[model samples]
Target: MTTARLDPDIVARLVGDAVTAPSMHNAQPWKFVFRRADDVMEVHGDAERAMTRADPHHRALHLGCAAALFNLRVSAARHGLRARVHLLPDDSQPWLLATAAIGGVPGEDQELAALHTALRRRHTSRFPFSDEPVPDALLDGLRSAARWEGCRLTVAGDWHLDTLLGLVRDAEHREDIDPLVRAETAAWVSPAHATSGERRDGMPAEVFGPRSSAGSSAVRDFGRDRSMADRGWAVFEERPQLALLGTPTDTRADWLRAGQALERVLLQATADGLATSMTSQPLEWPELRWTARDPLDAMGHVQMVLRLGYGPQGPGTPRRPVADVLEIRD
Candidate 1:
């Protein structure tokens, strides 16, 4: 099969779709470089946006970037192109996370292409979810989505859900007291910066959702430190539905796979008409993160905790321009 060269405009459109993927605090720590001659797009992790205090090891960074890579693949499939992806292509350049050689023909990944409709529709909903449980079939489909990307998605049981909620509360308390951690989080979520349009990344006040009026919620309340006028409080569900995405090994490659799996599950959930949100708050701390996993469960290491139910979709957050993150080489 003859492969046609990918035009720069098409590459830009792909990158545009790629950046829409969710990230840690919406930090968007990924960059794309397209080689016109080779028709390949390189994904790189930007160290400048790294959460030094929270994610010193850059595990969250890898997850966020890999999510974008997954979006790129989906975009390629939707655009009648094939993205041949390689994770960590060059050992020498550790920051270069992955590369996708674009163009081979359409219909190679029809499943991925189908998820394109949900790309922009998926949002991190932090609002209170209804008590209605998600259908088991839908949950199974989400599990399959994760499995396709080389990860496992396990719906948390009652006991595990309670434990996970406690861990999240514990982590919240830690963040409340730790000055450095609070400062780091505060630096990323300023309403003034967002209002001025100076900052293209980070969580704005509008997307923080409401504070829990009663009962503990798995969603991270970003409004804890900042004062937001009229940020109404609502009663969160007593038994919030939660799912854990895990990987067998805890390596850089494993993190990348988990990231891809994370996006896949999220997109599938969105397509199935479920509101979704994720919390890495507990996972940021060593002790809390370790205890988040169930001993008996086959899921080796929990990568992300996801909340799925019926709720208000989160407001769209800002993203850096494609030109800002993408570089084209002749």
Candidate 2:
């Protein structure tokens, strides 16, 4: 079968759409290469950007990269092309997480292309949220989004909320003591530099929501270590509406699926006019990770803690230009 060559300009445009995906601390730890000869675009996890101290197993790294892969698929479909993906195609080259061959007409899967608009709009909102409850129907749709990707999304109830909030606090305390974890987070966040002068990757200080004087344990304080004095303070919701994105198994493939589901739910939420933030702190800890799973529900493994509500959307984080991330080869 002849593999039709894709134009380099089209590949770059699709990748620009892909790198908009969210990553932990906005690390943007992924790279893509398009093989014109094979019509395959390979996605790789960049070990240089890996959070060695916090995510030693590369779970978070995988999620972030897979999220980009999901975006690539979405972008392709929206452009009237289809993306056929293969996860971890070469075990010998472990960093080669996935490869997507782009060609053919878009699939009949309407939902896949539906998220195109949300791709550009979804941002991680770290600011305080109003106490308004999300509608059950919207929540259900988010849940179904995860289900479609072979994962589960469980909204925390009153009882579960308290437990999850405490776990976040515990995770924060761990970060405080672990210098390496603190360093990893500090390196990524820059509040002083404007977006124009900023690096291509990492969380800009503007997106780091104001430190809470109210002492909310659920929200993370990115300014704690960096001490951005200019960053103001705000009151996060007393009871934040949170959800757990989980998968039944913990493997490279499951992480990939969770990442896709995560972006899907986030984009859907964005389209619905909701702001979102996420914390994987508890999941970063081996001792606390298992307990993050809902007792009543068999979630298996919780991949991320999502905060959802009405609030100011976070400032858009920086992404490496398509030229930097995607390479073309014969």
Candidate 3:
């Protein structure tokens, strides 16, 4: 870190790491602009890449982009720099979600830098997790991770978890019947590596994991319509470990906060040797979203539901090349 402007190469590297952050359907709806003059990097929500049907309010869009912002901060700290973030800095420019001014000395934030290792190692594990439970200590640490970003992480109890699973089923039924929602999801999913050319984004067929053989799947089945004869099937954990991330208020700023927290929790879980996957099916529907929350808990608006346990870390999903997602300006 120094008073001098950061190098463009370093900025590019930072953005490269940032873009690895997850998005719903792996849409990767984020863009980065590195202003070499000011040593600042800007993160923008890519409306074109947004899941318009599932996320009409762009709540998930903000979450995905903010996850990238969190990654940028982690990258900078790893490289002996500081990323000073300004959330929703420009009201007139709504899509301009955040800007990270880069500068500082070595060891700016050891905690943030520590998460750098998990950046690339962490992938959404759509595969089945063992029935082995996640220890309470690890879960507590994850809660702290979310709290550090001003959000709440509540691990659902048995009854609450069952209720969430029911909501997910309900949401899935609604998605099956709705033409627009189904089309939107299908558009972002690439079958067998890619139905098209070299795809830089979207959940590939290989990562969809084996279809749940049991009565109901705790995870979202992306390939429900596709034949599972080839993909095979497995019985998921009888009681899948679940957690909910939430904010006290539902606003753009709150969504931004929740996104960073979501990534933080995920990275921490990855570093802790836990496989993770995100489920927002219930949160995507307005009517069912509120029910996803625990009435006994104080969490306001639930942002994401996560499954965590020991299992195969799912293969990497495609991310847009840095050159495609990042721009450098003189």
Q: Please, what is the TM-score per model? A: 0.97, 0.97, 0.97
**To one decimal, what is the Cα RMSD in angstroms of model 3 from the true structure?**
1.8
**Which model is ahead, 1 or 2, in terms of lDDT?**
1
lDDT of each: 0.91, 0.87, 0.90
Clashing residue pairs, candidate 2?
Answer: none
Give the per-residue lDDT of model 3 (tens digit) for 1-330.
Answer: 334467768888998899889998989999898887778888999989988789999999999999999999999999988899999999999999999888877464779999999999999988889988999999999999999999999999989998999998899899999999999999987776654559888877888898888856778888887774678888898888999999999999999999999999999999999999998898999999999999999998899999999999888888788999889887
Query: What stretches of model 3 exceed 4 Å from their correct place?
Result: 1-4, 106-108, 194-197
Q: Residues 55-128, candidate 1: write the lDDT tens digits.
A: 98999999999999999999999999999999999999999999999987866498899999999998899888
Evaluated at residue 44, the lDDT of candidate 1 is: 99
Query: What is the overall TM-score of model 3 with all chains considered together?
Result: 0.97
lDDT of 1 at 26: 93
Candidate 3: C-alpha lDDT: 0.90
Give residue 255's lDDT in candidate 3 (0 to 100). 95
lDDT, candidate 3, at 54: 90
Alpha-carbon shift of residue 190 in model 3 (angstroms)? 1.4
Root-mean-square deviation (CA) per prediction: 1.7, 1.3, 1.8
Residue 186 accuracy (lDDT) in model 2 = 84
Deviation (Å) of 329 in candidate 2: 0.8
